[model samples]
Target: MGILDQNIDYDRPVKLADGVFWVGFADLEGRLQCNPYLIVDGDEAILIDGGSRPDFSTVMRKVLQTGVSPRQISHLIYQHYDPDLCGSIPNLESLIDSAELKIISHADNNPFIRHYSVNSPLLCIDRLERKLTMRSGRTLRFFRTPYAHSAGSFITYDETSGILFTSDLFGSAGAFSNWRLFADFDKKCLGCEVAHPERPDEHCKETASPCPWSGMHHFHRKVMPGNRQLRHAMKVVKAIGATMAAPQHGSILYRVEDIAAAIERLQRMDDIGIDGIADAASCPA
Candidate 1:
């Protein structure tokens, strides 16, 4: 699937909101980054998505060091079932108290969860039907845009801070480390842009092109959304005023500009019908 490209040192937490932190994996290149959130409110904490494959323990250790014990994590929310994002669920559950952890997933994720980890708890939500609220005063509203990235794929919106813990929706390339916190991201990302990119085969001739990122298929590919669904996701996100997108990979984009731009681009492309089970091709940098 995906190689262990870069290893991010979980030295300290990168604060995304007052009670939230970016606790996922980072890449040296600018192509993709996974930014799972560690949110602490009152005495309890919640992990949005388990980090990448290699860094699960580090993520667990970092979460425990918050003075909140392993049993303190109230919830483990899965935006979707992509292995890059949710691969650590089985391992994490073994280390922590599963009884205390309520795993959250969209309603359509039940069957997949049964196939992957039958013992794990799955809390599904119908994006078109209702919203789920966390005890920390954060309201998680879902938007079902299946096949946008994955069949059961959905986007979760946090109403409290205008943040969307989007799984794979609006991601960029590059990994942000401790030395390059959110503050220095602008400068660090500039250097990363030259060295690290989403895809490089674009520069090669059509026949000569090779897929360096074909490995990305282990996760989910970037499938173009239908005109109707694209417009709907765009309108909903803009209406919600999503200030920052905590994607499953890469550094967080502060504004909705990039996501908005992608929506516009998708609309211009030839309209494609949803197959419910199709893969999105390699994402461009």
Candidate 2:
């Protein structure tokens, strides 16, 4: 994912599924982009990744645009400790006027989120019950995947939607400023007809490809430690069999084929260590 060429489609929030919406934004100062998901269930609303601290206003507005108030947010799930992944959490606690707010993450990440999750008790999934059943009967399964980018990194799989919220595991570089949502993109990939062939990748020969391999490759190499850790994580991702994958970075991925392509590509790629700066740059959208 090279610098995401700005597009008008990502200027507003878009619904990804029945009760799920993808609210991604570009950081004006950093020029990087991050995606946060809003999951609404009966009497419970889960928000995945709250953008960076500086991005709280924009992120919250997008969340509210989904007709979701802070009071409705019950759980805040963190995929990892990256500023882009869980940075806005501090602001969210102050912004949300809720009383029963609960934070969820891998047990190892408690220390990292302890600062902002003061008001709410953190329920570390790998430490406690693995499955969380919401009031809506929608269940989420959590997997402990450490050392991809951080030791407390983890992934959450939503059984209800067959979508897995992978923190940094399946992320690609660049923001999806000029991209389509999962359902539409999935249909194109599955049918071998890409809506726009302009995506930055030549890996897939599909016409007008939807696969963002170029970005994915750049991201994984720079972040992940090595193939060992990544391969172990990929096994878990493949076993989960997520039909749609939502990463803290990059576009929302739909369709098993496209998802598999990412997994396979990462599995075969080399790793980079503590790179000076990420291939993605902060630029105006």
Candidate 3:
């Protein structure tokens, strides 16, 4: 059966791969939902982009459901300094209560992340050669995607699972009514028709539809700085050859085709960030 046909319990941790779990809270009422992923390799656990303070209880509950204790989480990897990702660092540290626990992030984000009153040692990804090796010999490589959304923004690629934990690069915002963990698309959606045959150069902008591309397009234009930064980030994603993409704020792109389509759409997207402002300013009031 397809993933949508499966009976998924959102309250419990959803397994994405052998040791990777989606520990995010699925809040249907929220416009933007945060996705926090947990990677348990042997006895070592890593939390990627742990959600905000208000989401701690729900996020923690899901994490615990994965059969991994808070203490098992040796590293909390923050892709950026956004509060949606790093706001609960102090809370997590308090629960884990271990000096060995480290908060891993880019050096550019460390200074801002420290404002959370984090007790764990802040380890710069650059200092670690941009890779983290788990006890089971599994590796996670970090790729910097600056200006995609934040100056220190980066993505984590799990070598074992080939899952890319993208921060905000592939995030979407308008799927609340029909929210699903995995991307769902119509047969004629932009994702399916990569060439845009029916619409002919006009990209999908209907956010209410099941088309993941529409929501993704709407999100990138608002969050990412510009098309240049987004294109640069897409290049990194293409080079990584990730089989799946799990973003911090949207449905996970599990299929290879969906991942590729999302990357292409972003690469071609225009009127983002400053360009968007410039376009709006040029329009007659």
Give Cα-based local distance difference scores for all models.
0.57, 0.70, 0.84
lDDT: which candidate is best? 3
CA lDDT of 174 in candidate 1? 23
| lDDT, model 2 | 0.70
Q: On lDDT, who's better, 2 or 3?
A: 3
Per-candidate clash tally: 13, 5, 0
Q: What TM-score does candidate 2 reach? A: 0.79
Instruction: Name the regions of candidate 3 deviating beyond 4 angstroms.
Output: 190-208, 279-285
What range of 10 consecutive residues in model 3 has the weakest lDDT sum? Answer: 193-202
Q: 1-285, model 1: which lDDT tens digit per residue?
A: 111122434465556676777765445444355667877777777788776557787677667666667677777777777666677777777777567677777776656655546455677766325476667566668777665555677777777667787676544332222213232122222212121123522322322322212212212223434545545555655666687766676435564554454445434333344322345344343
User: How does each model score on TM-score?
Assistant: 0.69, 0.79, 0.90
Model 2 weakest 10-residue run by lDDT: 190-199
Runs in model 1 lying further than 4 Å from the true structure: 1-10, 29-32, 127-129, 173-231, 256-285
The positional error of residue 195 in candidate 2, measured at the CA in angstroms, is 22
Write the residue-wise lDDT of candidate 2 on 138-158 in tens digits: 888888777887788888888
